[model samples]
Target: MADVFRSLNLLETLKESIEHNKLSDVKDAVEDLLISRINLAVIGDRGDEKATFINSLRGLSAGDDGAAPSQSPVAPEEMASYPDPKHSDFRLWDLPPAPSTSPFEPEGYMDRVKFARYNAVFMTFSQPPQPNTVEVFLEARSQQRQTVYFILFAAAKGTEKTLEETRKASLEVLTSQGVALPKVYLVRPSTLEKFDFPGLLEDMGRELPEIRAHALLLALPTLTSTLITQKKEAFQALVWAAASLSGGVSAIPVPFVASMVDCSVALRIISKAQLSLCLDDESVERLARQRGMEPTGLKALRTCALSVEVTKGEVKKRLAAAEKDLGTVSPKLVEMAMPRHARSASRSFTAMLQALGGAIEEMAADGGKIVAAALGEGK
Candidate 1:
């Protein structure tokens, strides 16, 4: 929301000032000092997978005459085959948490992502992808300049306990990286017509006033700008899911994003508003127990009220990003970075003004020389 404001350039303000010849030197300096800002896309890849679907919670039975609860390494295609449940996924890449026996490796065989740009990071386990862990990658993207990420073979569903683990894990990464975080927003839709998209966005902005602070760092402006900005257009397919989570509209303090310690305003906002992940429990869990352990009491990671919705291409890109996410950026780090940017803007523009003065001097010298030569010669 605030992206438009942060991107606002002082140079534009100086354009009027340039009309006066007295400040032409200043204008030259401003022009010279202008830094071309680029929209860099950093994508991380997580692996992809195939999962069995069944209507019975009775464990293929959710019990003993039940199908084995554990997946077998040697299980044949026939053993794993089950009726295609009406299973739909959440925003493109919401995977179930997959655990790993082997360390995170990039051998490339099972990895689904192929083409990548930006700083690509990978995250995965031997098991298939899960929803909660995927949030970590999403969180990482928020802290970066412009990021889009993924997860392969993830296994964490939108359970409470999984959310706790995800938050802890993300905090550790942010503590290490030391970068300002961006708004991590999830674009899910609501089933209750009362949850009108525009009203929801307005309410969300009210809940997190910080969103009005800076431009959200995103992979493609089109995805967030046109779609995410509009409730109906953005939440079209996503409305299938009950709820979604993302960072606050703006970056919060480090302590809030980190330990969730000391119980501050930022922490309160994060605990209440930011969603670590979202998905359709009806399609995936059905009769399975919905609740899980989560530390954030206010933000009880609920079983989504809506169905999951996403495009195939988005799924592919998200999965690819998951494979690459090795670190996370946190709000705590962003607060710490505030001091750096404070001096950056003022100093940069001042330097440009000085440079403009020098340019003016050179121009004046050249003009004087030309006039003198004209007089000395037969001009």
Candidate 2:
């Protein structure tokens, strides 16, 4: 068979090459190994987004005959107009707000190939808003263009004497691990309703849309949304804001801080086993049985960017320095806002990390960045 013959030939070649000290054969074998290693190194160097961006660069973005030429992009209004001029994968464009009533016209100074990175529109809160108003396209688009976005939505409660209880409750929910975090935007929804991508684009300030984010945490009620009154609008705004961040844009993960979780379960759907924590005595047992989790001494965690109506418990204790660092804590001593469980989680971590156990996320983020920087130096 072909396989048997190949195996015999390989063995003979290996023996003869080794016995005769054939340096050329050794060189060829090493070259093969080196090529494989380089391929792996290249893959490792390219992270998820970068790899995808490379494919898009090859005009392989569209299906079938959809690939655009790496040289010239199609329309001046195309998102590809802002490709990295140097073949880098990043870009940002700014354009003016298009007319609310009419279609958004593309500016003339754009690269016909890449649209997304071509125009950086500057938005003004004027009566008759105009796209391409002040300045239009900045420069030539190439492979090196790039951009990203970040939004912070702190839904923490504040210290208002009359609304002390309201503040505490909101804090509890925000800090609760099970609660969902919502996105926030100061978007002009009137433009959104009219299918005005350009106007919506205008609202986001026409920079190349890349990574969009929303961070929800403890904040004054009005600054966030009052649970009773503006809750609905706040929730809707969050969804719209995230949806608009598209095309190579990665939506930032929402960190649901229980301005008070006595403060964070992550997510997907709550399993039946997890849902029982919301019910009463008999109902708790019943739900537990239905969900395939143990019913005895059961407790549930209702967490999300939004609320999942449940009975909330109160804990009063001065939050340690870690919890206090969350930006919403009262410097004027809070009565009793303790997460005793946070201590257990902290037990396994460093002192500073443990103290901030109440904020699993901030600790991970800020801590990781610092650690990476420290480690990077040695490298």
Candidate 3:
């Protein structure tokens, strides 16, 4: 119910912006939505664990280009950064190990790593929380950094009972050290879709800012059905924004071809959705490699046309087809919300909304198929 209201409120806001000729603001909002940066800091003692975790987070193998070097030792006193090859705006920073001294100063360590810059922080450890790491978590909490997470990398395959026991022990250690309500996520870096990684992402999505959460959802690999659903919601919000922008742009008396501009906007949105949903050839190949399956098998599961190659011609065709189905595809709420004078502009808005909405749904379905095939779920 809250989500529905929120979406309606956003639509109302965008409608007013378009009616008031605030096109520049709408453009800026769209640009920010598409290109915002999200910095994630991973703090851990073991270099290899941190590197492997970072690579998995970025949907890259250790040997893949731009992947964090598994063999490279993390600097003891400095931070190292690994940018997501697909989305440069999303960066993962590897922070140095916590101070081992008896009287650890978390403030100094935070300052050294420029902790305030990160959107979220992940503290990786194998065993129970160390005193130094607990101090850092306490300091982060004191500073109101609510997105900090404790990650336990269980390298060995363990039973669910053993993993649950480890998590409880870690939380007990944190509470023993005066940290309140500590939550530890036990995960195997090689299989992030398992264990508590999905829960960790859900918590992060709830804690981070709305736009940053959307960026995180779109930037992450679609490893599970839950993630694909989340990505679909995010892209739906994006489609609303793009549709509103198209309507606003059409109202302007620009010299350039309006259809060309609309096609360009639709192309960019669909192409981005394609890659984010892991429907692209490269993303599919990487997922297949990670799961030790043939890429051809996973590719065969994609039933959407836009799931493979998103070309301008296809986008234009979708837009034109949507124009003809405007009466059916157009949302009644959007039409009712528009001012009587702007009914003409609603045509472009409705068409673009329907076109992009369809594309997103198809791609999301394809993403689900690929995930199932890769995981051997249907078999």
Candidate 4:
């Protein structure tokens, strides 16, 4: 058990630095985590259809001016790419649509696209996957890449039974082709909130690498509870990283008036988490409006601020609680060099993270209520 805690080298380094005042190391470590980008390639039978799907994935409506064109054709030679509307690091590429008339006629189709460059590939089809489509998918899979097959159908097509049939058919085809089945989803762009759209996003989150998954989750619009939880988990992991940074920086004296030791680092972590969670006023307002409520975004923002204070207060409370028992605790070699306040800073760091977690929980609960209420009103 002792070994487990000792194994967290970064956290130890972070706490030491913050307790003593080592700012440079914390800066470098934090910056290193901020710059990674995750690429996703979306390929389909038609360029226009692929673009529309891309738009839908980004949380835009097909008719919205900013939406990807569903009718505007992509020239055969062109490849289009778009940043996830919410994040620069997560990019989606519309690989030139598969060669329908001649499956492999273009000599360098596979070579030109460089399927391996992308972290994930999305193979979409409006109807059943044609031979050409399957061939391209097989080529992509041959690269040992993560590939997802999306079967998009119109809402008017049929009942849930019809959708299942389509899914089963796609499954049978892939099974017969001998391709290891990647995750598959059936969707209707018109009714995105209703069916498998959230499922598809969750599966993608599970499929991507950690940093990629983090970027993707943070960028995703908060449409479902599962998504909110994923975001919270991702953000919590990041907060640990932030705490590690605080611990690594050289220790600074606590501000004359403030009770918390490393206010700047804590604030930075909280701000970044807020941005990632879209807990900002504008984002909260937009989300509330989407669910058919008057603007309560500011109220949510206030809750986030209050959460931080609450967390700090809790940390102080814990420290006070531990004071009476300090006489019974034994000092170890690790504490020899740390200042008297080191213990307090550590407690404070923990409090900040807990506060952030509490804030997110409250925000999610409130947001869920609004969504549920709106959904009820719609019914």
Top lDDT model: 3
Which sequence of candidate numbers ranks them by TM-score, best first? 3, 4, 1, 2
- Worst 10-residue lDDT window, candidate 4: 328-337
lDDT of 3 by residue, 1-379 (tens): 1252263235566667767867667676777667779999988874567788999988998878888886555556777888888887899998876878987799988998999999999999887878998899899999998999999988666777787888889989999999877788888887899888999998987889877887888898887898988788777777777777776667667536346547777787888899888898999999888889999989998888899998988888888899898776535646653555556777887888788888888889999988888888878
Per-candidate local distance difference test: 0.25, 0.24, 0.81, 0.56
Please give each candidate's TM-score. 0.21, 0.19, 0.93, 0.70
Model 4 C-alpha RMSD to native = 6.7
Candidate 4, residue 140: how far the Cα is off, in Å: 2.3
The deviation in Å at residue 96 for candidate 3 is 1.4
Write one digit per residue (lDDT tens) for candidate 2, span 1-379.
1222232222234333433445345334322211211000000011222222233222223222432233324332333323322112223232212333334343443333233422222222212212332122112122232221111111123223423343344334333523234111222211111122223333432333211201111010111112112222222222111111110011112123222122211110111111211222343333344334555534322222112222222112212443345444332211111122222222111222222223222222322332223223246
Q: C-alpha displacement of 15 in model 2, angstroms?
A: 80
What is the per-residue lDDT of model 1 for residues 219-281, given as tens digits with 9 covering 90 to 100? 111111222233221121111010000111012222232122111221221211111111223
Please provide the root mean square deviation of candidate 3 (C-alpha atoms, Å): 2.3
Better of 1 and 2 by TM-score: 1
lDDT score for residue 88 of model 2: 24
- Candidate 2 vs. true structure, TM-score: 0.19
Between prediction 2 and prediction 3, the one with superior TM-score is: 3
